[model samples]
Target: MPIEHAMNTISERHRADILIIGGGAAGLLAALAARRKARERSIVDSDFRIVVLERNARPGAKIRISGGGKCNVTHDGAVGEMLVQGFFRKSEQRFLRPALYAFTNDDLRRMLRKRSVPTAVRDDGKVFPVSGRACDVLAAIEAELRDASVDVVTGTRVRSCLRQNGVFCIHTKMSDFFSSRLVLATGGVSYRHTGTTGDGLHIAASFGHDLVPSSPSLAPFFLRHPVAAALSGVALRDVQLSFRTPSETVSRKGDVLLTHKGLSGPACFSLSRDAADLMRRESGGEALVNFFPDFSAEDMQEMLLRHASAHGKQLIRKFLQLQSAIPSGMIPLVLKQAAIEGDIGWGSLTKNARCRLQRTLQSFSFGEVKAIPLDAGEVSAGGIALGQVNAKTMESRICRDLFLCGEILDYAGEVGGFNLQAAFSTGWLAGSSSASGSAGTGV
Candidate 1:
């Protein structure tokens, strides 16, 4: 944050064959692709005259904070699933396939290793740099840009963009820039502290791209239940959070952290993506949690009954406290909420109390979700319509010589490295195609 734009930082107005307005994953990848694809070293080519402008003084600030500083570069899953069912439409998937193929997750790992950041791939196939530090990932990527001879301009902000003589001219607070090709890897609206202030949407909208209102995806929820408040600090693992719409029920399996607000962690983050989407509009949606997701309602009821029958000599208060299923501090509260007196031993339990225990433990319900704000998320949903782009080339059909990639287009994937993979794929295509100037929005 101590970066200052000395006189050297503001050299002069410039022109480039390809100008990128961001230096995040997509932007940096564009610089790499352009550097790799240029025809000749002559000014005529200028290696596509690549110039990457990042508002952040240092590149990859978000990457430094990703995966809780571990840098989950890419998920360890079949790429097909990432491209499909999560949220993107068919055309969006098609538009992303080309770049994804060009630069696979393995390729990213290899690059990181070369930069001295040894990487380890988890059993789930999520590739992380060996150091398990996001700073290392950023270092590797930064090294790539430096080695690729990318003209990266950090702390440069674009004020406006204009179309002139079929070419786009960008006006920035630092200076004006012109480029034969323009790529906006400005990222989505999430993590504003990392500099993704939704600026790309404004720039793309100015260029005639449709703007989709981005919401907080992969964010924590706020519950209205006092029980939730009482159990706020308790962390639940292997939980199932079912996201409910008017017509469908979908669930994600993982760990969820109980916050004063609601839930967080992978289970909640994954569910939050859908929660943010389905609840983006005025109509509300609800997230129902199954704490003991591994067992069915009947199985849980049977377990509770068995425990009660076995501990018939103990009081309900002692029963809850002695059990490992719920938090110890919450035993009295849980029993009280179940309307069971805490003093009576398990043997003194009436049939009504036993039934209450079964009902309370088997399936608990939460309230209708009012909203999940955009800023609370790790990623934002919706982007430029992918239908107007070329799936193989990542070229834009709406504008000749204009290519779309990353979150700039409306192809948001799930959490855990899918989105970064998406960005890498589209950025590769856009950067490679930018040199030829034949790219079209994957139509």
Candidate 2:
């Protein structure tokens, strides 16, 4: 399957029992779940039509490129753990709970497994197809669509969504559609290249939903520190990164990659949302990188003292190189930042110098950090507020028969497989609930 697009010609007018906007992960899963629910109610025999309107030429553009083309499908963990991760706001968690519990990560893997897509979970619990090909995952979903008779409309950007006389009319460049139930899974304003250009936000707002004010969620931070620029390509494993704002401090731990511009990788991306959000409010924020997060400054100082007592004649640089996990290339930078002479022997090291070295090794600072942009993130945060949507069904309280889910909602997860799982879960709920209703007609 070489990224097949629905290159079929658009129809002038279409009618469906359920019309789902966006053919991304959420939309596709919603369609599947909707049809499943419809069949269980004997609604399929009634000539029920389900359509997925995709703006791009093909479906799952983001999925094809996610996890470096491997597609981290979901995080492997207990459902309780995933819920307590604080990915969604406390108020919004109530709304997300039902969908997440209803369709767990194991459920997702089981669905893929049935389609011949074997998955493996990493040590950190991130799940990806063993084939390491995102297309396989997409192909599996596409197969399900074909099996369920989902009418996928591609290369058709939706122009407007309006409800009149209890029927939702969706206008697209390709055609116009009328349906009793309409689902907005158009995703958030990130990855514009993948066709997620914040279209869902405006559509949801038009239906009387309030937005949460969007920003980049799992993005990298641009450091103003010159050393970080020079240390580009240096990777630190299990490092802890903490950001300090005037109001509060937030931190995350994972592998960090020093990029030419700033910091990236799991640790940085996990904390990027808070950093970016803080920067938006005001300035004067700093990131403290705990080189040895497990060790306290006092602990390091005591260890160094014992080492100095044993190898008093050795050079400070050599002593650190031998006793610590800090890389050889990082030693010079650390010594310089600590204002300690690199050539100084451990025996000659003063008490003041010992404390300084311990502090530097414990917490190195990136003076000021600025995030790239919301679009640079894997998923955009903020969308239709959770208060207006039903958690059990994903249906809109403001408007009848209109549903919203995925990144189009205010919930944004961290850099694991959390975001994708959220999308799939919400989409399933929305689609199932949307299709379970009686088919309505226009005025």
lDDT of 2 by residue, 235-281 (tens): 87788898888787889888888888778888888888887778788
What lDDT does model 1 reach? 0.70
**Each model's backbone clash number:** 24, 0
Give candidate 2 regions above 4 Å deviation.
Answer: 1-13, 85-89, 226-230, 440-443
Candidate 1, residues 164-211, lDDT tens digits: the string is: 555667778866776667887888887788888877787677777777
**Number of the top lDDT candidate:** 2
List the global CA lDDT of all models.
Answer: 0.70, 0.83
Relative to the true structure, candidate 2 reaches a TM of 0.92
Q: Residue 176 error for model 2, in Å?
A: 2.2
